[model samples]
Target chain A: MNHALDTRHAALLLAPLTLLMLLFFLMPALSIVWTSVHGGQLDLAAYRELLTSALFRRVLATTFEISIEATALTLVIGYAIAMHLARLTPSARAVMMIFVMLPFWTSILVKSFAFTIVLGDAGLVNRAISWLFGTETPIPMLFNRVGVVLGMLNFLLPFMVLPVLGNLLAQDRTLQRAAETMGAGPVRIFLRITLPLSLPGVLSGVLMCLSLSVGSYITPALLGGRTDMMMANLVDFYTRQTLDWPAASAIAMVLLLITALIVVLLTRVRGGNVEVL
Target chain B: MHNSLPDRMTRFWRATGGLIAWSGYLFLLMPTLILVPVSLGGSQQLSFPPEQLSLALYEQFFTDPSWWGAALQSAKIATLSTMLTMLIAVPAAYALVRGDFPGRRFLNLFTLSPILVPVVVLGLGFYLNFNLFGIGGSDLSLVIAHTILIAPFVVVSVSAGLRQIDPALETVATIMGAGRATIFFRVVLPQIRDSLVVGALLAFLISFDEVVASYFVSGPSTMTLPVKMYSALRWEISPVIAAVSAMLTILSLVFSVALIHLQKKSRGH
Candidate 1:
């Protein structure tokens, strides 16, 4: 029968993806799990040691702080853009989407390089400020938390806007139109009608922004100074710097745990669609 | 008659909202666009608004042998990985979209799971895995690692495209005595060709832009472009960085426009 042949074709098709993922992805990931528990023999000592370290605590705290701050700022900026996009005609939306997606598609290194050009001591921002205000001092923009957040916010804002716009567009607009016809004040109409309706998008945007910023390494590494460190930086430090594979694996597990727990908890709370890309 | 209190208030609100929205868009574009003028900068220093307009940075980047070597290595890796990823992902996407296979959800999750892990961890995994294989310093390892990183994008893109197609056409092809492979090649593949092209381009971009994994796996002689850029940013501010930034931005914009145009054309059909 055709059904028999179709099943075989399906299995044949799936074989390569299965094999490559198992060999390349699953095996390497399992090896990390194994490494975390085994130095000479099976144990949880690596994770224990990692948890007990002051550096671990500081790095985790910093990662969360930066991610939360970045997500908040991105939500504000992204919500505005998505709101604007939600009202546009299809052709105009396409053009605006290109600009938003440009930074998303560009190399992270190139985007960070742009920050180096703009936010450096002698960079464009500093140069402009000096000219405008006649200040002799160049602001300490790069190599700090401000620089790190600014760079990361550039990347995360687009992610927030896209999904929010999708949700907003899919939403029912009759209620808003009815409210407008009923003479609800503009600010009151938005606060009472649109904002409440878009909460799912906002929630999804926050989760996406938070998860991405939490794991981000490149932006912070380029923009932040020595004292500013995140969880992924610690993972890199152990893997590359110290060659402590077990310790690195342990920290990675912890990082994954934090991110997964937050995502699971949020989905449970809101029961919203969480389509993060 | 339409200029009531609410209408007037909403118009003002819309004006401010548009202002805020455009500013946000500008903020997003500012970093990438700032490099354009700097790329034309003549002075050796990485300064804004060049002392004179010249293409020295571009000239410097083009003339450097190491830069060429890195670019070549990146091209080789990206092309190889893109080919391999499509070879693997296209079939998988086909199965996921069309098959009555069991454990389909699990298979879908399995393909996308790589993205859930932090890239730093993924890089370390590749580094250690390669070392264990005793192929730690080779370009083969880089290519393989990049394939794993990029294959998921191909799968997802192809899956989306396949989902857009109607199932009735495929069934008709099969009922007309076409074999599965023939149907795929003649009927299905043609429909999803745009997806295949866009997915391959995404795979290439992901491989080309990947730095963390390349940083770990790359030996002294095999650094990729982004890895080289990272190292340059670490030691000194090379004026050539602006040129590279400008070039990469152009490449990305062109690729993105191509992707969008292809998708729009496909959707029009």
Candidate 2:
């Protein structure tokens, strides 16, 4: 009776989630991969087309360039903030941490719109510049790479800060004190001890920011100019505007492949143990 | 290259670090602050200092039927999507945490891969599949799409909570002659209740703020607030958009504060 009851409980606990995954998560993902390859027949033509297209090559390069810039900026800024939080009194740390997280909890779309207003031609920055400089023309800040990078960094910074903060909280401060007592200077201790110890968190943050920034669709679309269109935007245009599923799926597959490769390379270089979440 | 030189260099580095940290804080805060005053502007175009300050735009958002209707529809979809995500995530998280089963690792990855997949691809897949079923532009489609998108976050959070619990507590309760269902309800549920709430709240927020998926799946009448804002921003920047954005920003801040409070309380406990 106990065995039978155990089996029944297991079945009851597992059935719903399993069914949902099979229907929604697994099926849709599989269908996307399958459709990309065999929407009509077994063909490498879509893959071939993407590889040979100069437009795609440029888009891919731009995606990587933007993601790298965003990742680098997030790390430098996030590290300083995390260090400050670590050194703060507990109550002050908590309050400041909440402030750091404020933008993250807000919708990315809302924040992007805020950037648009602040950076637009007739917007605040330009208006302020015109008043100060007595200039007739508003600065061309929006619809450029500067606008897109600023918008992307606004979203990516929190992701970088949180992971590094988690690692800092988990760190032992006594080691730093011991190093100081052993005649090591503050810079020497930080470089030799603290920085190396925080590598796990730093790598985790880098991978997370890089992947998200690369896959991001909305920020670039809204803040970017026509020439700044990334791979995700191209996928959207092909699928929505051009009505080309095969081509869209092909682009997605390539995106997935590149992302997967980068993740693999990151893990390998970082010693293969980082939780991305 | 001497002892006093080291002290001076350390002090200089500390000041530089402090300066960078404060600048970073400013970078994060300034963009968010720009929206608040703009929402209060009286002009049709967006401006920094208002020639006139009026509540007319906020009033328009409240009094206008189309705006209110879109807000209501978005709220309804978000609510339904949150419910669906919680329903799916809780049991899945439970099994992954407690059940020692085959393919569990694969299942975990399968659930999370949605986040890694580009949104455009997911949107395309839904557009095609929903169109084939004749449900492409329905409210139900949006709800289902968002549920899939957010369930993984729910799973991760709840699983983290599960890992934190001592399994021996549950084992002891079982050995005390409590039935499995009784143990699960009386012992397990109460322990993880806070985490479950946090997870569900996060799911709700994700669904509430969703835009790209809604843009493709929603009909004209079923458009969410973000979709409306997106369409408007493409043509013009008005204080009305600012009004809507300010409302959302405030709501999100409230939720974020609550989430932080809950997290601190849970950690304390």
Which lDDT value does model 2 have at A30? 63
Best by DockQ: 1
Instruction: Tell me how many residue pairs clash in candidate 1.
Output: 0
Off by over 4 Å in 1: A1-5, A131-134, A262-277, B1-4
Interface RMSD of each: 2.2, 3.3
Write down the TM-score for model 2: 0.92
Clashes of 2: 0
lDDT of 2 by residue, A43-130 (tens): 8787888889998899989999988987898899889888878888999998887678877777777887888878888777887798
